[model samples]
Target: MGRRFEEIDWRETPIGAISLRRRLDPALDVDVYEVKLDDEYLMSSLFTVAEVELARLALAELPGADLDVAVGGLGLGHTAAAVLDDRRVRTLTVIEALDEVISWHRRGLLPLASRLTGDPRSRLVRGDFFAAVNDPTGLDPQAPGRRFDAVLVDIDHTPRHVLHPSHAAFYTAAGLHRLASRLRPGGVFALWSDDPPDDRFTGTLAEVFGTVRAHVVTFANHLTGGESANTVYVATHARPAGLA
Candidate 1:
């Protein structure tokens, strides 16, 4: 129906040159949106089960109302939109390292752009997610030291495989401790990974959170003509023993 392939936007960011492209898939008979960081494929609208699940599975761990949530990446706003879907979420702060990606959403370059930018409960912030966790200001800059009910991350490929060297620290126990400090008691932390369930990372999370789970999310893969899977790690911050 449309052009076979079109690059919506391309910008050089601090991390790399990120690009947004839309192409018509003849097999699926639909338009697919994709994001690329330099030569590496970052995300695609064709397969987003895990991205949405990152928010759904994370929020499911918390049984609370009027929840404030933070999302690490704003790639296509899939994960962020999933968070807003739950009516219980009171506020959402999306911390994205690349301002170019945020501009794509605000400029309505993607399908979910309007939904994310129009939503009054959602705020798109230009900041580094991993850096914020390791900072005293925490995730939300406006409210320093502000804690959230849940933190869902979908930035790097996996804990071990990171885009930059700086991200490796956040996967460590010490770094996780810092991340845990940004959450309220009983809050949850979830991450989306391209690889299968990693036991070593689970052990590292166990040291920081009370309960940890590695979820293998499978979705139909049109390109492969089969199913592909991604991992979602959900960890809940333990409440103080005396607290009820």
Candidate 2:
């Protein structure tokens, strides 16, 4: 028999309805939510295989080095938690735009978020990631003069399809050039998408970075007993002096 949804209490924001559901075969509990305008699946606490893989790939590119990692989104804190698992990571700064989402994690409503919050290496910034990345004044001492070793961005469903219109620029050619500037020499930029990236985005990455690779991850559905696939885009910068 198929599983049914049950109510889950949310103390942070009243803009959406939250619920929990159970799957028969896998026999797991999943947290799901429906936002006011977004009818699609916003997020869940189920399987996070792809999210973990994204972190793993980014860390692998920076092997044997202590890394200052910057994460663009903090959904359910799965990716953040995965990134923090690496002892080589010196510091992890997550930029999330939603204050209510931050509250959910800080208040212990989102168990994963709460756990990540306890980690001394983790800090959250409540603002648009694009603006934060482009800030020149270096208002935040932790960010100024610090080029990231790895930037893991999961703010969009797909590279071509962004949830927020304001994020469109970040995936463009010019925008990618700006993003590449934020990376330290030999740094990596990792992006997760629900589908394979469009050619334009891939072309832009090729233009800005020396090495670019794409990988697809497939997993069995925890809820409906089906299969799903997602793609991750990884680009590594070349030594800057070579560019000149």
Candidate 3:
């Protein structure tokens, strides 16, 4: 058996100190990978149903093949890997704020590192996701004002509870409009939230997109022996009345 607990990587980022750790879980008899920022747990390999669902549900909203996608966070690479699982996905650009987290994938520190980095379809870009959404050039720095078929985000805990005060604006209707501007017509935007469904946030999404859904994804919690839930908000950009 590998070391029971090993910190794979640790770095002090502008936001806070982040670390990756692996621990053998006796209950499941598997090594569990975890990520923590400061004292707060960010993500875990043990519970990734919702992160994978974030990519699945968003892509389901998209219509055509050869889809170009963008992922906001690169926590454990579960979400990004899920995006690439769809054979229809032609390209994936993951925007990560911390270079440290990106390095974890590039260095093969995380379990899904090779799956993500080795994929020719994936590009791990170091930049602020939220900032890029609002930029006139949009999410892809290489292609200015480039629009995507779908944009999946798992960065913040919730619309109301953000990692930083600056991120709170991205949850607002106006901020969503900025994000919509970065998508092709009929494009979809999906977000993962730790909080339960919020009616107010749903209303905000309705203001920007034609269709909005709040999916409550429940998964078995190994530690608690109970089911825990996460929310995924899927919003589709409405094309002009005459356009396809």
Per-residue lDDT over 1-244 for candidate 1, one digit per residue giving the tens place of the 0 to 100 score: 5899999888888788989999999998989999999999999999999999999999999896999999999998999999999999999999999889899999998999999999999999999898899888999999999999999999999999999999999999999999999999999999999999999999999999999999999999978889999999999999999976
Q: Write the per-residue lDDT of candidate 3 for residues 1-244, one digit (tens) a residue.
A: 5899999888888889999999999999999999999999998999999999999999999887999999999999999999999999999999999999999889998889999999999999999999998888889999999999999999988898899999999999899999999889999999999999999999999999999999999999989989999999999999889986
Residue 237 error, candidate 2, Å: 1.0
TM-scores, all candidates, are: 0.98, 0.84, 0.98
Comparing 1 with 2 on lDDT, the higher-scoring candidate is 1
Please list the C-alpha lDDT of all candidates, in the order they appear: 0.94, 0.75, 0.94
Clashing pairs in 1: none
Could you tell me how far off, in angstroms, the CA of residue 115 lies in candidate 3 after the best superposition?
A: 1.1
RMSD of each: 0.8, 4.0, 0.8
Cα deviation at 127, candidate 3, in Å, is 0.1
Candidate 3: clashing pairs of residues: none
